[model samples]
Target: MKNYFLEISFLLFLLTFSSLKAQTYARNGMVVSDNKLASDAGVQILKRGGNAIDATVATAFALAVTHPAAGNIGGGGFLVYLPENGQATTIDFREKAPLASSPTMFLDENGKLVPGSNHDSIKAIGVPGTVAGMFLAHKKYGKLPWSDLLSPAIQLAKTGFPLTWALYNEGNYHYTNNSTEFLKNYFIKDDGSMTSFGEVWKQPELAKTLEWIAKKGQDGFYKGKIASQIDAFMKANGGLITTQDLAKYQAVERAPIHGTFNGYDIYSMPPPSSGGVTMTAMLNFIEQANAEEIPFNSTAYTHLMIEAMRRGYADRAEYLGDPDFNLEMPLNLLTSKDHAIARFKNFDKNKASVSDSTSFGHPYDGENTTHFSVVDREGNAVSVTYTLEQSYGSGLGDPELGFIFNNEMGDFNAVPGETKSNGQIGTDPNLIAPEKRMLSSMNPTIVAKDGQPVLVMGSPGGRTIINTVFQAVLNTILYDMPVDESIEAMKIHHQWLPDVTYYERNKMSPDTVRALEAMGHEMIPVGQLGRLMGIQFFPKDGVYFGASDSSSPDGAAVGY
Candidate 1:
């Protein structure tokens, strides 16, 4: 295994790369997040002798309060935990469709989609699983008391934290420009204006909600008064969630999806999330084709990467979904190296492959999510990525509950059997079903060398998540890039249906763009890709280093 400790020594290394950007370094534990306060809170948990699992549970809850745009208890996601002395495992907390939901729920009388019903309305919310997921992680692996892990978030919500310019800017823009009345109510002051930057923004109701969980654990939110209130609110607002759905919601602890990438063990959340298998397949394609020999930023290299992404995404739409719902899913085949090589038989190396249809069963997630990575002194690592489906979720919040509801129901294939060229997937495996967890692209992952977890990584960009994470692993382990560069490196995404390869604007040379376009690939540009949080550990001295995404204005990598 390569020792990054020697590769980027300026901050966390004993050697130096060429003018590498600054990175946060530490001798023992580290926490990385897009929210500084959330990172600090996780580091505090580490300082208090908590394990990586404890710190991550704390960090996720803290983000729920501090970064409402994505961090959420009103939403759900996946968590991967790697212990120094124990087996690696994952918690699948991807949200479930309400019991009343159906394959045709989003369709109108004419069988067309009910306009805005999938995301813009009350029916979009799923039975939330964040609280249950965190609870189970703590119950099985947490070192600190469950209540202690929640204290930081509770305090931040109750006592208030200074609103950052990013939040203020984004929130105010929506508040003013959005036509929805509910959108205008977010982050409002008593005078009916949007909260300003640098002002203390408090959510006392959210604090109370946290207090309930702290006192009674997951039941605090999924049952009793909170569940009753949610049911009542749903009834009043024409939402689909019921108290039964809340009571029946259970965050499952499933075996980690395991793959070998160039001798490193890649462990991640399994089905219900297409991330791990898809990413591993992409890695397999790259390794099988020996594409690493090509220059990293050249058009040829980008073409190969985009083809791999297209195939992986294409297979995802056809073969993957909630494992419990699709018992026949070819999990082993999809993640195998052989399957990857089989996929590349059509690769021309010089051309971009068509992405209209996948090789398997059929065809086709959100870009609004948050991820954080935690590493404790004992060598334990935790990677978590969660989301509410969109910015401000459903654009609906309860003053009484003090949290936005996730529109995650939209994640399920809403229009069955109607795959579209515009990126709308209607694959059967992902069609909405009662009590089924929607398929996700949230791939929180850990890379272990010689059975020791060395890297904990994940990102949030909906469908872009899998590609970003796939590259992060390949960047660090295969290309041997420094931790910061692994995260900040220019990235591209190509989910199958859209048939458009998106490159981060200004990051790609115009010549490179034209060169890629010459390969029959339709290329577009986006302002950014996924916002990643990552950590690399060097066991020689038990040192830990963190790299937060540069895209987040308030993000940081905190360590001690």
Candidate 2:
């Protein structure tokens, strides 16, 4: 009887393993973001037999309607796609420098640096490319009809969406001190208070624009009435974007950055994004450290991760730039085993490394951006990262189209400096050269095993994008946690500046914090960390599970 019981137990173990593997099916899909309706809209597309590319286009269109404060048709972004048989590809649709923009545009008459260029329409706006990128992705791999994918966004824009607490709060925070008449009339309530949560906000003009695009295809915006309006508005407002810029824009398809972690293939956006190199460097350094042996979330693990972040960020500040303009970076800096071994040689358990020691190189400018991940029924996956440069973009919107413009010009270094040996300058590589794309920190990534996608994830946090993605992957892979729990876990970030480590309040253990403090580290409690979205597949059973950040008001993972 004892022997029989043992045999039964062994059978049960095999069944459990089989169940886990069987859960990975083509039909499983997930969408996550700061808006619930948008996330649901993407999942709906997935449920309707759309592949990951279709779902991404759908979600992106919906976000342009529902989350106008952060996403829009006026911005630009990067798209990373992984097909079943080939290497991943990255689409660079990042906003470009406007024709009127010059290297000295932000400099004062006295040659002094000027602050707040991010808020100026003349200095803020870039040639928008969001629409072009979406259309391009759809053209290449989307299975659903483009018009069908656009219908959901059109409905949301025409009928309006109720404001969530998060949206209401953020709007109030950003618009409180605005003195512009245009913003006051559009975003503020009648009684001098910001619009409250639950209020229905309708964007009729945007609805019409989306509808036009649905009917006319890509030409709807680039060459039709919308383009004319955008050109006229920029001309009137002293901005540089013209109808020609819109008509000339095209999304470039480039090779995706490839790396490996514990036999899983990792793919992400390459330059002009710092995400690929920085994330790989951190992960490579950690791999050399044998970080898995440290207790998960323990002070030692946290400390080492932060140290790695510091080194990676320092490298980012010195060596990263637009590859189109700069000489090819030593890609080996992040992929070489010898380089990883050398980086880990400086690891010290009890003291913080000086910035100068890690800051041996000079990278280019970093800018604001956001990311989203999607997986659909056909086993295809896409990770897209989009941005308007900064919040409210250039703080200028084409009055007629109801869209904000991108302030991508601030991504250029305004200071005059000599070019480095690698042909990178602190200033010009990402500067206001005609049609040059700005450098970004948006990193969207996918993890595949045995040539099939196993995980999809990305985040929105400007310079912290790499750190957020790296930690989440560690949680899911090294720590062996569920997708939801892994994303929900508290996160810490170190940007190699101000010489302090930032932590999310009340999420990390007090013991961990105490241990780091004792190790001569300065720690500050940050209220919230960057928002992350992810989905994991159980290959054996063909089931997909999704997870989103809990701190976000509207993020969700819905699976049938």
Candidate 3:
């Protein structure tokens, strides 16, 4: 009887693990985000007959209340929308420098970076773009009322939700590390102390704020009461943003960057975001090399990937920037097939290329972020990756407004022509300038076949975001990896500087690590690289399969 019980327990464990690896399938709609509650909020919209764009808007708002670590109204990011019928487009609501900002805003008199000024101070905050982006997206593509779409999030804020282990840690971080009097307000804990696991967290102030947006739409935040409050807050503090900055912020609708890889059509965000251009270039290189024949994570395969990343990121640092600011950007030349092939032609598969000193080709190029993907019954897909720069952002929240401000100014190259070996770039393209949007790695992408989206996905990993999204595309289209495996696969990151390939600890075999190091490449081990959320469409069965990366303890893929 004891042996029989042991056998049953073993079988149960196997079944549980298998189920976790399997996709969550649905017939009409699917929403996948880093937080289960946020995914449920998206599905809630779909249940009310909302389309993909509407569902995504709901999800983004819900994340603002649930995933406080990254999801934010005080931050900004990119959005890629692939409607079933209309032309594919992207919304660039990325945060911009305030009018009072300058190139040397974060520098001292001696031209050195001010300690913690760029990332942890009021000076680091930019004009937020998330609310503007969401409103613009819904204004163009939404079927449901804007207020109705935000109902779920407002409800979550008004009542409360159980605190998860992940949120507990984040709140503790904010509660402990909060420095100034302005930043001392707790994340969601009204009692001013971190909550225990499973404790309910309610934000009455946030509910009132959402109610304003619900009633007045975009004007609710940027024009009237909220704007006045922000102006007053900044005046009381030392922040650069003012009522004029908030009132003038607008999200631009741009044509999506389109590319083809392995017969799969790809649509992604354009300039200011290095994602699409760099990812397309790297994908083009991998395709030209016929990398499919090489074993995954093998020494040759790893070398090929690193070389592609090296060249792509080098170009990114030199050329890409906000299109409105930088007119000389050679976006076409950088993403062209010829450019990719030339960049890869001299590659030696057995040897890794040096990435220490990066120089740009005549053609040119270009943070924490969160991503959620939504697909409705109509075949429309929306991919969004938004963030507050660093987790919890500036850690400063006005108790009355109840939202954290983003420190996105740190994304800028604080010093000119001062690139470093520790992954800091001081290139001209990304230099700080007033009213300019900072360049980003946030690339929300969709892959379609025969003009129908088959994959909707993206990730958040600061500099590693592009590479992580790049592999997700390759894993699905090139490798035929399962939906879950495509996101859960071992990932590596290589930016042009630092020249080190950072791998997830213990994810790769020791033999492969040694082989890679023998190829004259520096390798370092780190913790998890990204938390990816994605959905795979199987048109033959009229089914959608959603998968959230296991790295997010509370993450779930909700479908119906």
Taking all chains together, the TM-score of candidate 1 against the true structure is 0.94
Per-model TM-score versus the true fold: 0.94, 0.88, 0.96
Over 1-560, each residue of candidate 2 has an lDDT whose tens digit, in order, gives 37998899999999965433322123466666556687778888888888878888888988887666557788887888988766789888887777666766776897555777634546577788888889988998888899989988888878877877877776766677653445544554446566678987776777888888988878898898999998898788777888888888887888888888878888988888878778888888889878778988788888998899888876676666667777767766665657777888988977777654323433332344556778766678888878776665666776568767777777665544533333233444455567777777788888889988888888777666778888888788788876777777878988776467889999888887888988878889988777787888878878777766765556665555
Arrange candidates by TM-score, descending: 3, 1, 2
**Top model number, lDDT:** 1
Ten residues in sequence with the least summed lDDT for candidate 2? 18-27
Model 2 CA deviation exceeding 4 Å by range? 1-27, 171-179, 187-196, 357-369, 418-429
Task: Give the CA lDDT, 0 to 100, for residue 451 in model 2.
Answer: 84
lDDT string for model 3 (208-266, tens) is 99889988988898999899998888888899999999999999999988888988999
Candidate 2: count of backbone clashes, pairs at least 3 residues apart or interchain: 19
lDDT tens per residue, model 1, 450-469 = 87888889998987899999
The better candidate by lDDT, 1 or 3, is 1
Error of 3 at 10 (Å): 4.1
Clash totals for all candidate models: 8, 19, 5
Which scores higher on lDDT, 2 or 3? 3
